[model samples]
Every structure is written in structure tokens, then in C-alpha cells.
Target chain A: MSTPATPLTDEELVLERLVALLEHVAADVLEGPVTDTGPGSLRRLGLTSVKLLEFLVAIEDEFGHVWDDDVEESVIGSLDAMAAHISAAGVAPAPTKRD
Target chain B: MHVKGIESWDLAYDGRQALHRTEDGSELYYELRGAGGPVVTLVSTIYVVSTAWRNFTGNLAGDHRLLSYDLRNQGASDGRPAEFAQHTEDLKSLLDDLGIERTYLVGTSISTLICRDFANAHPERVAGLVLVGPPFSPRGSSRRRRIAKSWLAALDAGGPRALFDLIYPLVFGDKAIAEGGSGAYLALRERFLAINSAAQLRANLREALGAGDQVERLTSIEAPTLLLSGDDDFSTTESTLDATAEIMRNAAVEIIRECGHLPYFEQPEAFQDAVARFVASVEEGTFPAPWTAPATEGKDR
Candidate 1:
């Protein structure tokens, strides 16, 4: 008998979506394919200001979340951090299709 | 050129600032200052406001009627996602409402496109034209389009502060950045962030970026034109400005050294002097002379 696969939790879903969005928006800026999605991984991605903004916008579009002007730096330090912030804020994935 | 009998009316409107509602029901904030000379309407760029023209107004107001205003979707103006041609129409309505028959138009950056369209549409009403940092060159439009996309994305991501941080280096020259220092830069950033919301900027940028090619329309502008460019302007260079001026029947190039995209902000005195001299020349009917290469061009080298 085959074991059933476990469904992803809300936090896991957010992280999955975030990684996809980041990869799509930051493909040009990123040196290689993303191999890490752990905490503080974003800092190692070497994103310039323009690429960072693009990633932020993509996150907003994908997660239906708006970042506060004074949002803590740590909240965007990595894919895990962003997923955690979005989940804590009770944000859901937007129904709109990603470009 | 003699001052029209509109002096009394101009004086009454001088120092008067108010909102003028267009036929489309959008309210535009305009301020009239200085009187007794030809009206010089300062067209604000997508991000700039009337208040940002304080340097230009203070310098030229003594001899020029200065009219500065925020276009729709900018500053205190009300409207969003307006069509490109709507701004041209708004200019017409504003001039008509103010009873101004003819005027000199000074437009910077994206607003230069607006001024060009207005001049082409109403050549009789344009006494002179000053296009500063016009981004109309086909050679530069693609690069500008890419930068514009980055700006829009920045605004959507972190509002005006993010956008400012991204564009600060491109908008201001090296000299201005070095001289202004971090404190001044921070202060300017605060002021910019406080101006308009992200939604407003998005609307303006969409309309500006979606605008069609206006290169062919340059030949239609018959007013005595002065194409101003900052030496370090990345969006449009001095050679581009020279080429643009060559397309027009009556146009000249004036490059301000040590300045970037915004000469009026970075080098006000130089900007003012160039404009004043050009306006004076146009008034005296002494400009737009036939083009000629220097007789000693090869010998000088």
C-alpha cells in the first residue's frame, strides 16, 4: 500500500508561492536558480535596489499583502521571513493569475 | 515684445493660488505669480510640483509672469489614469479660463511632451518654448522605457521613498549629489515622499510611458524653441538635444554643465540665465538664424 502525501500548511503554501514569484521576477538579477528558501537566504541573493523592488512588488501581487513603510528589515530578510510575515498578517494568496 | 493690456488682470491673479476645475470635473491646482511681462507657464514633470519651481519663479518673476501648476494626478490635483492627450486639452482650458492670449511654456522631462503637443496644437498661442531634458529622442526612449518600468515597480513596492532611492542617482548629476550630501538628500527624499501617493504616481507614469512616438511631431512646432539639457542627464544627452533641435525649423540647444536631468533644481542660476537670454532673443526676433559651421573648424584643432 502507498502512503498518502501530506497537504501543505498555510505557511508552506505562502513560502511556495513566494519562491515562485521571486524566481519569476528576479530571474535576471539572480546569478543562478534559487536553491535555498531558508531564513536569511534573501540577503545572499545579491539583489540590487531595482531587483529588490521588483521582488517586493511581485510579493504584494502574489500574496495580496501591502508592506508598511516602516516594516522591519528582518521581515524581508529571506523567503521564510516574508512567508512568516504574510501568514502572521492573515494575508491569503491573491486569486489573480500571476504574469 | 510689448506687454498686453492683460496686466491688471494678471496682477489680480498674481500671488493667487487656487484649484481650477476642468470640463471633465477634475480639479487642477495652479498658482499665478509675478506680472507685467510675458506669461511663462512652468509645466510640472510627473513627480515635481509647483512648489519645486520656487527657484525658477524667484529668478524670473521680476521680468516674467510665472504660472506654475500641478497637472492632474500630480501633487494636489485630482484625477488618475488620465489619457496623454487630456493633459494637452487641460492646458488649453486653463489658458482660456485665465484669459491669457499668448505665453512662453517651460516644460521639463515628461512634461516636455505635453508642451510639444500643446505647441503643435496651438502654435499661434505659443510665444516661445523651453523644453528641458526632453525624452523624445528615439535613441533613448527604449532605455527610458526600461527605467520607467523600474520606477513604477519601485513605487508599487515601497511607495515614493523606494522610488526616490532608486531614481536619485539618475535624476541628479554627480556634482549635485556630491554637493548636496546625505543630509540634503534625506531632506529631499522626505519632501518627495510627502508629495503624492503611489497611486497618483502610477497613473502619471502609465500615461507618460504609454505615449506614442512624438519624434515626427517636432517639425510641427514653429515657436522659437530652446532645447535645454543638463550635461550629465542620462535620460537624454547633449548630442540628442542637438539632434532634436536640428529637426525643428526654429530651435537652439543650450547645455547646462555640471547638471543632471533637472537643471532647474541642480543649477538654477545657469538654467535661469539660459532661459532669460533665449526668451529675450525670441522677443527681439534675433534667434533661429540659419545654421552654419565654423569657418576655422579644421584650423582650430
Candidate 2:
């Protein structure tokens, strides 16, 4: 769901998009409740390493920006961190593929 | 007991090799042997099929109804693209087809991962767990990914023979390779070569490496578990078993000396003794938790 001409900065927009993407990608595990916050560790929410990898790949495929191999694991540690990484990498939103 | 070639020995038991169809139209071949006893099902290692457990089944079949099966796209089973969930589903379907209410599970290598997954998802169906030389992803995600990539790259570069050659030494004990008077090593090599194929290897590799982390779910497993490893094995060391057992409520670790990854093959007597003793203890309701018993007291090393 896209907001029309919302008064949000580019970084804010990227954060919003990432939060939506993560919630969408991990709906199976994270659907019951918002156990962890935007800055909290996703591992506590039961996002396994395999699921994390799949989430990263989905992010890459949707944004058309390859995740750098050297990127620290902390980048995906939380929604805020992931959004910051996306902003720093200058990734733009592309058409999402329904996996 | 000098057998010439593996062909001469009749590996098949009565009521052997039947296919059960899955919802996706894939047929999985399973063998049922012995009867009127506690049920035990063998989960095959990634590299070999049901026949790999023929001798092992012989050790347990007299007192326990034994079941063994070939994983999908391997051995006599029909080919389907491999996925982690498919293995669990195929196993669930096989157990249903055989009318087995609950069973003790013996899982080797990658199949051990499947066993844990199946148990976590359907704890009521699993009576006990026996894990042998199972692989687990290490600490880091990238490192784990790299390990999987390196394995696939080796397979893609030189195909199945390369994969076989790389794994053979690690799986068999160095002592066995150097001093087992019999030609078991060569025979095993021949079997590996005969079984190797591009599609089969690729599918098995995918299944082996694609399994998700079950470490967190181990605490929920209500079944008593026997964690086994070879003393000389480079993979899945005793420390690994200890870490795994710490989470399990009723778990014990057993280490077989002078063997490698495949303790059941290299040291069948020791393997059988450990299994028999464990099963007996479980049946008699005397199996001790790891906290109470000496670490190495379960069976003679």
C-alpha cells in the first residue's frame, strides 16, 4: 500500500518501505504479535539465519540492489538498521515479485 | 563370512521396497522389515539410499520392526525438485502409509536435520531420536553460506566423482582405510561411484544445505535422544553434541572410538551395542538423563 504525496523524507520513506517489506516477508513468524521493536534484535522474534538470508534476497530482488558481502550482520539486526543500510546503499523501490 | 561382491548378498527383507504416493504426485520407496515389536525407522544419509542401512537394520530388526527408505529423487524413488519441507512431508506420508503410530527415528547426516524438523513439527509421532554425524550450521550466517557455496561449487566444477572423492576420506576412519583387512573401502568406493549422478547429487545437496536452524526448537522435543559421533570424526565433534544436548531435556551423547563420520558402517558392533543398550534402557524405563550419569557410562567405548 502506497501513500500519495506523504510529507515524509526520503529516509523516512525507505524506512517505511523496509518495515512493510520485512513484515510482508516474515508474516508467518511475525504475524501473531509485534514482539520486537524497530531497534530490537529480530532473532528474538525467531527469525532464523536461513529465514534472514531469504529476507535479504527478497529485499535485493525487490529493490534491484545487491547486498554487499562485506555488510555487517548488524545491518539486518533491526528494522531501523536495515532501513539505514538501504538508504546508505541508495536503493530505490522496484516492482515487488510475489514469491 | 567372506562375501565376494555386494551383489551376492541378499539385501532385501520380506515386504521390501514399496512406493507411497504424495499429494504432489511423487513416489517414495520404503522398506519394512521384521514385525510385532517397537517400530524404528531409518532416515538415509544424503549420499546413500535405503540399502545403505541393510546391515544396520539386520542388527535391530530381530527385536524391533525396522523401516528404511530412499529420499525423494534418490535411489528407486521418483525425482522431484528438492526442498526442505518436501523431505518432512514425504516422511510423514510414509509413516501414515505404513500405519506406524509412533516410531524411534535413526537419522544420519542431513537426514538428521530432517528428523529434528519432523520431530519439532510433529512431536507426537516421534518416540525417540538417534542422530549420527549430523551437520549443523556454525555461528556466522555468511560462513554457513560460504560452506554451502563451497560444496556446490565443488560439485558443479568436477561433478559427483569430485564430491565423492572429497567426502570419502572424511566419512571413513583413517585407521579403517589403512588396516581393515577386508576390501570394504574399495567396495564402498564402487558403491559411491555407481550411485553418483548430476541430478541426484544436486538435489541431495540442496536438501542437505537448505535445512533451517532447529537449535531453538530442540527444547520442545519431548522424545529421549541419543547423540552419536565418531571420536576421530572431524565433523560433528563431541563438543557439538554437548551443545546440542544442553538444550534437549532427556539427551545423552555417545562417542565411538577409532571411527569417522559413519560409525555405524566402520564400527557396526560398537554402534549396535550402543543402540541396543539405549533401546533396552528406554524400554525398561531406566535410561538416565545426561545430568545424572557419567558422560561415557551409557555403553563401552
Candidate 3:
């Protein structure tokens, strides 16, 4: 059997680190307006593309990596969205969803 | 480019020694950038040096009459302990010095926490206030109280850098520190950090962290207030600071995205955008709901 699935790579580790930092940033500092899950959820957060760029700079600075090089816009847009990108990038730990 | 979208000037508040001096003989040094209506005061957060707000003042300089002062016994000012009353007086004095009648006051961190106290004491003096990144609670923690006590002791001996080194790391995330290390960003850390003495730094820190528990007086603030903050600021912890926001029935909330403790620095453009919108609403003589919290909460790993 293929050697038990190898552990996350260094890039993965870096991506995970980025996600962790992103989560902290989202929860503690730049909390957009609370968004309800619906077609209109995006309108409520009040986060514009400029705000997203700010987040992009933050993630780049924190992980010592540029935006496109490591993180995709899909990942940096929101906490879970960013985490999913990390997972997809083969970096972050699989998220555990709790109801 | 001119910071804050306007011209810049080296404005100093003169104490007896020279600069922005208070009635009690304290001094407040600050940078003035901008020209226009809607006079605004930007109170520096205690944890970081006033320069930490370069991103803030830089953007706000030209549009509105902006005054970002290094609090008394702070930022190239004298080394002395200051009380809430003393700060309120300093602000009033600064405004008077500039011939500004009633101006908007914007405070972050510790300064934001006390906007109400200032408003309560001198309601007629404040036109409007924007309280951003207020303290978690007004009640002093033992550690905080000890730090406050320590500041009284530390103020006289050293300079801003020595004091900043102790406090900066906590508020500044890895980016600022690392970028600073990369020699990629401006290398004014030591210079900006070194401007004040240890005692003066402590005085500011003490005033900020030691200022715990003012929720009782929140209702007294009659000024139109805009509560600006980010959800991810672990230090202030939105829930706790929101209690104060809740106290101000007339207050509105603006929370940015992906910003940490110092969102103004982390995201100046966003900061400007959010505040500009708020200021517009205030000017239009109407207040909107501001930003609302997301209904769906993300789970922690």
C-alpha cells in the first residue's frame, strides 16, 4: 500500500499557518457585518473589494507569502472559505463541522 | 503624497517647555494633516506609538481637519501620569488652540473606551465621537492594574522605544514584526519606538489598560457615536467591548473583515472606506444600521 498517506507538506504547513492567522483575524479584528446564509447574505457584511485587498495584504504579511502564490481569492474571502482553500491546496487540516 | 488626502504640517501643542501644553503643564505633540470641515480628533491607542496611526492620519489628512495627538506625557511629550479628566481637558485645550468649536472625536483602544466619560463630563464640548477598538471591559484586571502601577514607576526612566518594545509585540502581529525584520517595510520601528521615555510610555499604557469598567456611564454619552471595530481583535474581544456599544443606544457598529488588533494599519483603505461612509451618514444628518453581523457563524477547528 502506498506509504500511509504522507503528512502535509511544508507549503501545506504554511497554508495552515495562514488559515489559523486568518481565522484569528476574522474572529477578533476585521469582523464584517454578520451575514445570514441566504441569497442576500453578501450584502450585509459590508466588506468591499478594497476590504478584501486589505485582507490579502494581511495574509501575505502574516505568512511571509504573497497572495496568489499561496492563497487563492476563494480561500481568503471568508473564514471557512479560506480554510476550505487551505484544505484544497493540500495544506490545512480537514475542518470539523459542528452543528 | 500628503497623508490623509491633504497637506501635512508639524503641529505641536506647547507645554511650558514648548508645544501642546495643558493647564496642568503637560504637553501633547502631534501631526496635523488635512484641511476642511468636520473637524476630527484621532486619539492614539496606548499600546502603540502615535505613529502606528500613520495609515490612519495619512488617509484622513486632507479631507477633514484632522488632529492626531500624542496624548499628554506621550509621543515626544512630557513624562507624567494623566487621568481621564486630564485627557478631556487636553483635548478641549487642543481644540481651543486650533479655534475649533465642536469637533468629532475618534478614539481607538483605551481612548475609545473613555469617549463616554469625556462626553459625560463635557457634553457640550463633543460634536460627535467614533469609538473604535474599545477595551473589553472597564473593570481593571489584576495584571492590568499591576501594569498601571508599573507605568507610574516606568515613565520617568526610559524612552519610547524601550517602552514600545515591551508593548508592541503584543498588539502587532507577525506581519509587522516580520516585515520589519525583512527590512522590507519602513525601519522607523526603533526611531518611532525610541521617541518617548519609559515612564511616559508607561503613563500612556497605564491610562489605557488600567482604564477598566466605564459601562455605568455609557448612557450619558449624547454624541452621535460610530462604533468601529473588527470581529477578530482578540485583545478587545468584540463581545465584551460591544457591551459598551450596547450602552450607547444611539451608537452604530462597523466591523471590517480579516483585520486583527490594528485594523487601521492592517487595512487602511478599508478603514478609510468604512469611516468615510460613516462620516457621510453623519453629515447627511441620518444614521443607518451601519454594518450587521453575519448570521452564519463559522466553527472553530
TM-score of each: 0.69, 0.67, 0.60
lDDT of 2 by residue, A1-99 (tens): 976886876677777666667778778657564434465555445453334545666677777767543454445556667777777788777765655
Predicted complex 3: CAPRI docking category: incorrect
Model 3: per-residue Cα lDDT over B1-301, one tens digit each: 1111211111222231236767777777765667686777777756544544554566666578777777777666663686655677777787788777777788876677556567877777777877776553544345445544554444444444444444455455454445433221112332333354555566666666546464556766788887777556645666665665676757776675555566666556666666666676778877656545334321110
DockQ of all candidate complexes: 0.01, 0.01, 0.02
Candidate 2, B59-120: lDDT as tens digits: 68778888888888877777577687789888998899878889989888768878888898
TM-score of structure candidate 3: 0.60
Candidate 3: where is the Cα deviation over 4 Å?
A1-99, B1-18, B47-54, B138-166, B173-189, B209-212, B290-301
Which residue pairs of candidate 1 clash?
A: none
Quote model 3's TM-score for chain B: 0.76
Where does candidate 2 chain B have its weakest 10-residue lDDT segment? B1-10
Compare the candidates by TM-score and give the number of the best one.
1
